[model samples]
Target chain A: MSPMPTESAIAEKRQQILQGAMEIFLHQGYEGTSMDRVATAAGVSKITIYKHFADKEGLFTALIEQIAEQRFNRVLGGIYLEKEPEEVLRHIATQILQLIASDEQYVAFFRLIMGESGRFPELAQLFVRALPQRAWKVLGNYFATHPKLDIANPEATARIFTGTVISYAITQYILHGEQIAPMPSDVLIENLVHLIVNQSSS
Target chain B: MSPMPTESAIAEKRQQILQGAMEIFLHQGYEGTSMDRVATAAGVSKITIYKHFADKEGLFTALIEQIAEQRFNRVLGGIYLEKEPEEVLRHIATQILQLIASDEQYVAFFRLIMGESGRFPELAQLFVRALPQRAWKVLGNYFATHPKLDIANPEATARIFTGTVISYAITQYILHGEQIAPMPSDVLIENLVHLIVNQSSS
Candidate 1:
């Protein structure tokens, strides 16, 4: 109507569609979701959704990719990879918990993925490739290079680091295990840091 | 027909209904699944299912409780609480992987829990209370009594232990992250045990 949508405007519209897709897909689930529902949720025409995404699968795949990039980049962005192990691990642990605390949507999306994994295995695969795979690699290389840590296997250590923190987040927030198995996130972070940086106890 | 079912016979039928509920609920989801579907899958009449389970929620609650007791008891039953940290931790780790490896049904049920947690928060709560809560308590108490490990806070340490191993299982089996971020379960188990008992490096 006004001028044709510019590149940035178009990108903004696309992001809006994805965000709406997340909400609808989570509520209706992958099988239950439809382009019509997504369009309604996004406040856009069905044709507009089709313009942005080839199909529901494409929309979902994009959703996984975007959520992964946004959350991981935000959590991993602040840390200087070269910092001491104690500082780096603490920063990572703190950032992860902080991000989970702030973002209910992301946590909900995680639930959707886990719940739908059996029906839509490819979605789970895309998520693994997008998020935890990258995390394991970055931390694995860090462990491998940090001679001081003396880790025999960097890859496994990387999984443990990311796994422990993520597990805590899932248990506390998603599983509501805080009531049943309460441990302050700070305590876990510090203890995890101590375990990794202070390995080889007397 | 036969005389009224004996106590053990009634118990067996109850178990069958729960198993069918798990399958239907896993496939159709919590909201999508109904008693009829469970009856068909379970080879029992809907009336029989009603005789045993009051509603879908009751059936699901029973599923959580039974799964927690069966797998956890199988895992925790063999380990003597009196063992050293190395022996105890390793035994728990191995037993978990073994159980996960052998039982696809349990793995699928885990995915179902994660996926359905959002819609049915109460189911998730039941699971945490039944499963992780017990594990955390046992391990926390074990760590507290074992002065040899010198753990300042056994509760957090217990969380780390269960959290790490469970996360590993989720990644390797549920997320299918093994190929992308491959670290054999044995490698992770050993590293985790090392971190816990081998803290305080030179």
Candidate 2:
């Protein structure tokens, strides 16, 4: 008996649905999740879910996009583009690790995406397109601005820099393996920073 | 009708079962997999799988142990306890990446384990205990041998090195997304080698 949701209200409701969907998807995976489950979790009716998202896949795509957008904004938010190259790269890696480790939703989202990636290849694509692509682009821009770093391949360097940080996080948390090698995150970052920031190390 | 198999033959057969199980487990996941599927993939009778492993968990455990043993042996195999520390460390990272990237079985094994890790928390422990533990031990031994690097905390350093390589692989293959960060594997190796080989800017 109430009035229909306004445009802003509808958008807000959609966000609420996505947040709930991410929680359930992270915990239960795409296959095991149901519209009823999402409805119950979001405290919305099943029809509302359908109204926002045509189906579960639609909901998932929206969630991934939202997470990707949030991560991109957070990492890109604090950059002092004109800072010293060494400190700049270090900050970027730190930001990346912090994102990977501190964000519970990010970790769970990563796990869910990775877990079902074989089945849902699109999810992986969305992540790369949304998050890593932006990261590499940002680093590439930084490198381009500071040609003095003598980094011949800024794009390649960006990938390696990002790769090293990601590798550290995955090994520590997901792999949870005993020290495959001894470089702690700080030491690793320090050494890596030294290697990349300098001009002639290659 | 055939000649009686020797003890080594029986052992070989057991290894074959484990290998097949690892593949199927990696592809199908724990919940999606069945003993019959493993047997079919292995080209062995159902009884052979049971003979070698008591159940699915037993097969998974045995697979983990086997992979751990192989990884440790490969990483530590040619490492001279007497070699210069920097050279040895770089060699280890380079070798580790080559192994992870090329070995189809390892890739499949990792994908399976990572995807299904949430359902089986014990799987995480098994992986860490088996692989990372031995890796840390090897790095520690290497550090103890080299007095030059003067690293106070070899354990942390080792973790970082391990994490970097894993991140590299995950981004390249597992996270496979569009506009992929394009860095030839050799470039990555060169960058890592640069980081580990030089302790000081001097």
Candidate 3:
């Protein structure tokens, strides 16, 4: 009889599968990709992948969750209400801009999502739940707690702030802002921060 | 022998072809659509379409220009610098929100452009030139001429203002805001206009 895999082994194998799945999904897109392709790319048996994830949909969901977690960790990780609001906001904006502009994988993933979400609208819902929805809740709560800032509508303000950042990213990366007059990331971020912070000051 | 078509007939035929092309392009996307389909949809011969437009690329460009012109007329045609700044800004905001949210053709066209633009980046450039770039110039010029406003960086401010509105549209419509906690369009526009107008006032 074959020996049972250790817990660590199982975790490592799951990670390998997810990483391989993301690469294929981003490159070939959701519909173009298949379980067989993911298995081949991961160099694991199809059975092994199934053991980790129920099916292709489950795998895609898991991948999105992973991405959201990784992004949250990278940008807003360790950030909280206690940190200076300006510094935290700047860091978040800078990180988001860098991810949007410089990260090839993120851009490819974004394009894949936008391209496929029309056909598979559930994917759009999954993404909205995974990232922006969660982020808005967290940030809005932070804003609400901080009475000094005097934000009238924390939820709406959070959406607007993040929405602006996201819009800049989409315009710059996805919409060919470079071919047009490229607004420097710093200028955009600075202006956004100034608008938000200064609005409160006044 | 067939007599030459009159100028009015030619214009009518061209309009028919463009209308058909828009429907097909929005439904099937750019790469999926073809000249033969457009001809069939328009109830015209392939030669007739070619007579109006040189090729598929030409037809596509003409269609984008038509969309831009139609949208401009509908939204900003009667708008002018002489109007109150608040009224003008609010009008523009309302018009943009209506277009982005309620216009099915525009949403489908936007999806088509975004979905296909990665493969055919020239489409992105074409769209940029057709709409937002031109709108920005006109709006920026209006802002600059308004000496009473005391605006700093008219160009950047105009971009930010419009960018915020566009971002709201994208999030609410394309990105599935309804699945999340939906914010009404009026709230977003009101908040955005308040932010910009109040920022200058302070």
Q: Which candidate model has the greater lDDT, 1 or 3?
A: 1
Residue B108 displacement (Å), model 1: 1.0
lDDT of 2 by residue, B57-175 (tens): 88877786677567656655775556666566667777777877777666666666676566665666577666666776777666555767655455545654665566667666676
Please tell me which model should have the higher TM-score, number 1 or number 3. Answer: 1
TM-score of each: 0.87, 0.76, 0.80
lDDT, candidate 3, A1-202, per-residue tens: 9889798988999999998898887766666678898998998999999889988888987887677567656555655556677766777878888867787778777776666566556666767776778778888887788755767777777877787777778767876867685777777666666666667434
Off by over 4 Å in 3: A1-72, A78-83, A200-202, B1-18, B30-72, B200-202
Per-residue CA lDDT of candidate 1, range A1-202, in tens?
6878689999999988997898888666676688888888888898998888888788987887777667667666666777788898898888888888678887887888887777667767778877788778788888889867777777877878888899998988988777766778898898888888876634
lDDT of each: 0.81, 0.70, 0.75
Candidate 2's displacement at residue A196, Å, is 3.4
Top DockQ prediction, candidate number: 1
For each of the candidates, what fraction of the native contacts does it recover? 0.73, 0.38, 0.36
Q: What TM-score does the A-chain of candidate 1 achieve?
A: 0.83
Better of 2 and 3 by TM-score: 3
Winning candidate number (TM-score):
1
Reference-based lDDT, residue A18, model 3 = 94
Q: Count steric clashes of candidate 1.
A: 7
